[model samples]
Structures are given as structure tokens and as C-alpha cells.
Target: MNFPLILFILLVITGSIWLLDIIFWKKKREPNENEPWWIEYPKSFFPIILIVFSLRSFVIEPFKIPSGSMIPTLLVGDFILVNKYVYGIRLPVINKKIYDMDKPKRGDVLVFRFPEDSSIDYIKRIVGLPGDVITYHDKQLIINGEVIRMEYEGDYKYIESGLGYIYSDRYSEYLNDESHSIIINQDIRGVQFSNVRQFQFRDNCKYRRTGFTCEVPAGNYFTLGDNRDSSSDSRYWGFVPEENIVGKAFMIWWNFGDLGRIGLSIK
Candidate 1:
């Protein structure tokens, strides 16, 4: 559902009703007469709705994690808060940027509208920036001819919704200045070229049996899920256009299954 659009609609309806009554309907009523329930309800709600709409549109917004793609960094039930203005202040619903701000950096966790389907939102870590050449082979990431550092952590185990328990190798990946953990299942190979669609800038990427290499197009970013082998990310689709960006996810405010995760800052 397009939540911001719905909230904007409600805000307009309530504000219009409240304004119309003040200009035309107020004096028509008898002096000292009580307001009708219909008028009273909308008038009372307009200010509150306006405040909520403003905050959600230009300041911050909340989103829930629906998949295990982010794994150790974010869980299935994690409710995260995204900083809306950190990247730029875009108009709500239309999402057209009216201000300029910092561009997304490598290793930053970003939430963006899926390039293939704008209505669907996806979250992934930025692995490649504009003009950077990214290569992934043998479960290692290389950017601009430099191999990103990776150190083996240990064996990691987790439970899948219906697959019971699964084990994988965990490693700490140092991408530029950001250090984060990732998991890889050696039994599964990387995405196959045949399974990928002819997305925009498809020619810029070359896929092989082991891995793939791509040069990020201008104003676009390459991303990947923390759960390496389990994620369906840029390797399978395409780059994330700058306009499709929503915001940088910064914190986990709630997690029904794990209260300990509340208030934890996102890496």
C-alpha cells in the first residue's frame, strides 16, 4: 500500500473541512450553539494529522523487516526508523527531491524503491557507488581493483521459517571504512546469468559461472544483502537509481520477537 499518499489524502480532507466550516459554516450556526459531531471530529483531527504527515514525509518514517535478507544486521520482525532528510528532502507521494544532501556511501544500509517495481521497497547494503567497478568471485568482493578485506568469524546457525535450522560460514567484511558481518553458504553458488532479467544497464555487467563483475552507472548504486548466498540483490536485478532511494535506515526501534534489539543503531 502507498501509505504516504493515503496519509496525505486524509490530511487534505480534514484540513479542508475544518477550513470551510470556519469561513462559511461558523456564523450560520446559532450563537453559542454546539458544533455538530461531523464538524467537531474533523476540526479536532486536522492539526494532529498534519503534524504526523509532516514528520513522516520530511523527517522520519518507520518500516518493518519482512524478510531475512539482512539477517544478522536486521531481523524478520525488526521495525526500523529511516532518516528521511539525511539524503535529501523530497516531496511526499511524488517523491521529487527539492533539496540536495549527502549521497549514499559504500557500506551504508539503504532502503529504496525496487527499480523493477517502484511500489515494492527493498533494503540492502551499498557495495558499489557510481563509476566504481565491482567484482564478486569465489565469495569475495572487489571494488576498483582492490580486494575488500574479509576475515573468518565462525560458523553461524539460524532458523528459517519453514526450513528448520541452517548452518553457514560467517565472516567480518571490511568494505572501505565500514566493517560488518556477512554469511555465506558454500553449497550454493552465486546467481546465474540465465536467471537474471535484462534490466537497465545490463550490458555494463558480465556474469560467469562463479560470480559476476559490473561497473556502476552514473547516479546509480550496487547493493547486496548481508546474507550473501541467500539474497536476491543487484547481482540478479540491476543498480538502484538515485531517485528510487527512500532513505538511510538508522535504527531498530522495535522487534516483537526480540525486545533486546530495541533502540539499537543500525550499522
Candidate 2:
């Protein structure tokens, strides 16, 4: 559901009624009789809705991780806080940026509207920036003809609810001077290209059995999940436009599944 849109509507309705009461009905009501239900409820909720709306729209917003695509960095059920104004001030609901701010750096975890479906929000790490040439082949990342450095971190064990356990090779990848861990299943063959979606700048990408190469367009970014082999990211869809960005996720405020993850900083 579109929670922000719904909140905005509520804010407007409640705020309007509150204002009308102040201007037309505040002193007219008799002390013995109760105020009209509509005025009473709206007046009671207006301040609260205003405060929540302001905070969520301009300061920070909370989100829950629904998948393990981020694995070690962000687990399923992790509740994260995204810094809204760090990217720029944007209008609520429509999410149009009205101020300039820092651009996303490589290795930053970001939440953005899915290009194919704006209603769906997706989170991933920034891997390639505008004008960058990115390639992934045989589980290795190549940017602008230079292979990114990776340090083997041994094997990562993943526990699935239905499946017993899964093991994948874990490596600490260095990109743009930042380091982050990623898991890749060597047993999985090259990325599948059959279900590739046609996206903006689709012609800039070349897919093959080994992997894919993409030349990120201006004002667009290439993203990938830390769970390399299992993620449906830029390799399958396409580059993310700057305008679709929601915010940079910075902290894990809560994780019902893993209490230790609470208060952890997101890289």
C-alpha cells in the first residue's frame, strides 16, 4: 500500500479541520455540550499527524527488510532507518527532489523506487556510478577495465527456514575505497538472461552466459545486492535513475529475528 500518500491525505484532512475549528467553532461550543465528533477527532489527531508527517517526510523514515538479498549486511526482518535529507529534500508522496545534495557513493546501501514499478521499493548497494563501465564475469567484478580487488573471507553459512543450510564462498570486496562483504555461490552458473527486463539505457548493457557488462548512463547508477549470486539487481533489470532514489539507509534500529543486529550501523 502507498503509506506515504495515505499519511499525506490524513494530514491534510486533519489539519484543515483543526484550522476550521480554531477559526469558526472554538469559542462557539457550549461548555456543557460535547464538541462535534468530527472536530474533536481531527483536533485531537492534527498535531500528532503533523509531527509524524514532518519527521517521515523530511528527516528519516523506517523500513523493514523482507528478503535476504543483503544477507550478512542486512538480514531479513531487520528494521532500518533511512536518512531522507542526506540525499536531498524531496516532496512527500511525489518524491521530487527540490534541493541538491550528495550523490550516492559506491558501497553505500540505498533504497529506491523500482524503475519498472514505482510502487515497489528495492534496496541494493551502489556498485557503479554515472559514466562507469561495470562488468561481472565468473563472479569477479570489473569496473572500467580494472578488476576490483577481493579478499577471500572463507565460506558463509546461511540457514533457511525450509531448507536446512546453504554454504557460499564469502569475500570482502573493495570498491571506490570502501570495503564490504559479499556471498557468491560458485555452483550457480552465469547469470540467466532469459528473463531480462527492457529498461532505460537497455542498449548500453550486453549480457552473456558468463555475466553481463553495462555502461551506466548519465544520472543513473548500477546497483547489486551483497548476496551476489541470488540477487535480482542491475544485472537483470537495469541502472537506477537518480530521481528514483528514496534515501541512503544508515542504521538498523531493530531486528526481531536477531536482536544483536539492533543499533548496528549499515554500511
Candidate 3:
């Protein structure tokens, strides 16, 4: 979550409630016409409760898909909700896990803090799990020393998704530990196999051109995007630490220009 937006919302809600109480609900016996210290005190908690419920229940929470990284799966303006407790219930802001829910599967779309900058949130798929060796050479996924069968029909065309764009290809991978549909575009190159250098976990990753290999750290996991070629993810920013995980995105609640986009599960 963005700090500025969180702080601004907190201020707005707290300030609104406090102002209302002062002007309309002030105790008649109060001696001071000037603001009372006690009223301001409780006003502070309005934002606190809001922040708590939002962070705790929702986990990763809802964020505008800012870029096309998860395109075809998530759009730029698609308002999607992430269930914070899907993977596990974690405290908001600090992001401490309290209870276990489920482990990340190969095909689930997820949101996590950027390993490079924990302040920034990035979305990607669980292409590789802890102890899994993943290779993406020539646009094919190799896991644990075997190619995970990808059929290529040559170039795929994609429409623009929000602030970013989407390329389409028919891909099928695993979810819930089973094979499913995934999208990839051969054009997505550049940062696909390279891990970001300037952050934690540099010792855990290795690089190559035919493909790169990284050992998913014990407490960390690797992620990719269903919309390949368009996402800046763990492949570039490094692995998502256990603490940096937000939640699992389940559905598209709303989308602009495409009313039909509502209620689509991530594939």
C-alpha cells in the first residue's frame, strides 16, 4: 500500500469525525469553547480501526493495476480485491503473519512488496516455489531440470491494458499444483531472466541468457506474471520475502469501459 495515500485517508476520516463531534456533539457542561483535548484523542482511532480492518482482512488489499504486467489477467484500471488471508492472515503495514491459510501454487496471481524496494508493491505469478529450479529460455519454462511443455503459435497480439499494454499467447501451467492456462508473448525480453542487483538476496540468484536460474530462498519465493513480457516482477526485482507478501488476488470486482470484466477469476 502507498504510504501517502494511507496517511491522507487516515487524516481525512479522523479529521472529519473529530470536527463533527466538536461542532455538534460537544458536551454542554464543557467549560472551554476552544477545542477540547479529549475529543481529539478518540478521533485519532477512527483511522486506526479503518486501517486495521483493511489491512487484516484484505491482506494485500485492492490496488489499481497500474501497469500491464499482469495483463489479460489484470488490467490497469481493473479494481481487483486481494484476500489478505488467502495465503495467511498477516497484520497490515508491518506485514506479520499470524495464521497459515494456504501455500502459493504455481499459477496463482499474487501481490507482494518489491524485493528491491519494500515500499513498492509488485504483482506476479508463482512460477517457481521454494527449492524449485526455474528456467525461462527461449520463452519456455523449465522446472527441476525438465521443460514444462509450452506450445507456441508464433506471435500473439494484445490490446492495451490500462497504463501498460498486453501481449497474448496461449500458455498453460500449474495452479493448485495442476496445469492451467497462462499467457506469454515472445516479445517480452529485457528484464525477464535478470534479477535486480541492488537489493537483498543477491547471493541466492544466478544469471544467463538462454535463461537465468535462482534458488528460491527458504523464507522467500519467486514470482512471474501471467502476462509475460509486460511485468516487472521477481525476475527483475528479486524474490518476495515472507514478510513482504500482501495477499492473493481472487477476482475483478470492477473495471472501467469493460463492464463485462466483473467477476473474472485469475487463470
Candidate closest to the true structure, highest TM-score: 1
Candidate 3's C-alpha lDDT? 0.70
Which has the better lDDT: candidate 1, or candidate 2?
1
TM-score of each: 0.97, 0.96, 0.75
Scored against the true structure, residue 166 in model 2 reaches a CA lDDT of 73
lDDT of 2 by residue, 1-267 (tens): 999998999999998998888797887888786888988998899899989999998999999998888987888889999999998999999999999888889888999999989999999999999999999898899999999999999989897555777789989999877788898888886576776888889999998878889999999999999988778899889999999999999999998778988899997
**Deviation (Å) of 58 in candidate 3:** 5.0
lDDT of 1 by residue, 1-267 (tens): 998899999999999999999899998999999999989999999999999999999999899999888988998999999999999999999999999999899999999999989999999999999999999988889999999999999999888886897789989999776799998888888675666888999999988888999999999999999998788799989999999999999999999899999999998
lDDT of 3 by residue, 37-109 (tens): 6666658677676676566445546667887667556767888888778887765557788888888877777
lDDT of 3 at 27: 62
Error of 1 at 249 (Å): 0.7
Better of 2 and 3 by TM-score: 2
Residue 24 lDDT in candidate 3: 82
**Ten residues in a row with the worst lDDT in model 1?**
187-196
* Model 1 misplaced regions, further than 4 Å: none
Query: Least lDDT summed over 10 consecutive residues: which range in candidate 3?
Result: 190-199
Q: Which ranges of candidate 2 are over 4 A from the true structure?
A: 31-33
Runs in model 3 deviating more than 4 A are 1-60, 152-155, 160-168, 175-180, 187-198
